[model samples]
Target: MLFGPRPSCIKRLLVIEDDPLTAFDNEHTLKHAGYDVVATVDSGEAAVRFIAAEQIDALVLDLGLAGDMTGRDVARLARDRGIAVLLVTGRCPEDASDIAMACLDKPHSPSALVAALKALETMICKNRAPRKVAGLTTWWRPAAA
Candidate 1:
């Protein structure tokens, strides 16, 4: 241990999206943005399996997934395991702020998605307030002193 604080790095990610086209785009965009896309799954079951087995730093989860479990279910599970989450949907769920680090609305640009993740990383890992970015509703707050 040579450091006072661990490095703030949010790298590996799992994307759970029901739409094949959107999933592809999210995976492609995140990889281009320098994140390791560990896996892109289309259902909650697959997402659960990945969550149980993989070392994921974050999730890009679609609210309406193609399985019994909704994105909120995955978000809760991921949070229990200390993984961060970024929920994506047309309309955000009512309890989104409780379960995710941030939420992003649908039909957003790839650049906007990338920016949202950057902002989330700053807030979650760096513990610093991030500048506002379009299409992101952040839920991260600094821990109380």
Candidate 2:
């Protein structure tokens, strides 16, 4: 019998922000938090293309993008694919509550961003089949049983 460990599924994240600095910071923060940031793009069109091609698990989006298509438009596409979306913007839109998993205002600390991602991860994990290990519960799947 071929015995092997189960593969771990780390959540894949995509960051869509127009600002170069903000995009870099968000990508760095997500990577530091142990999430795989698949891509960091500055336009809604590019985000759409990336989402279409990549297996994105979650998205951190900015409402105001440099392109004609805003983050809200991208959020719709991401949500349709069952990807968790977090809106981070300087101004919160009224409809934001309807679309995203959560909204974080701009000037948010890195800790806040990390906390939001953790919360989203927990929520995602809870929705799936759970497993217990060492007297604790985790949503992460092991490589082998």
Candidate 3:
């Protein structure tokens, strides 16, 4: 629990990365940036499982998973459930499909990741959800609360 208190107080992020090293680095960076990482799954299947069982506020999903399912699939699932998403990939999608809260390309620095998370938090708060996006999202009506 990086942000502290509750999931609502810390922007909860679900990471679906296929590389263990990258996932670890992203988790560490996100923790330092004050986010609560709900789950770090290496495959799209696990990502779906994690989301189904946890209370995730947003997703930092990799476009390439180790399994058959892609990040876009996970994004679609999350969007269907009203969860915000941040796509971490090399190329950005061009369509007006379900817009991700933000997008970060590969080889991102910790500072850049932190900034993205902060930006995503802001976007989530501004989405007419009556949520608070202070140093955290504790001001909103949390899903678990």
| Model 2 clashing-pair count | 5
Please give, for residues 1-145, the per-residue lDDT of candidate 1 as tens digits: 2112222477899999999999999989888777889999999899999988889999999989897898888899998998989998898878898899888999899888887888777987678887897778888689666
TM match of model 2 to true structure: 0.78
lDDT tens string, model 3, 33-92?
677888889888998898899998888888888989888888889978888777777666
Clashing pairs in 2: 5-143, 5-144, 6-143, 6-144, 7-143
How high is the CA lDDT of each candidate model? 0.85, 0.73, 0.70
Ranking by TM-score: 1, 2, 3
TM-score of every candidate? 0.91, 0.78, 0.77
Ranking 2 against 3 by lDDT, winner: 2
Cα deviation at 91, candidate 1, in Å, is 0.9
Which pairs clash (backbone N, Cα, C closer than 3 Å) in model 1? Answer: none
CA shift at 34, candidate 3, in angstroms? 1.8
Scored by Cα lDDT, where does model 3 land?
0.70
| Candidate achieving the largest lDDT | 1
lDDT of the structure predicted as candidate 2: 0.73
Candidate 2 per-residue lDDT, tens place, 8-91, comes to 343788899999998999888777767789999999999999998999888889888988998988999888888888888887
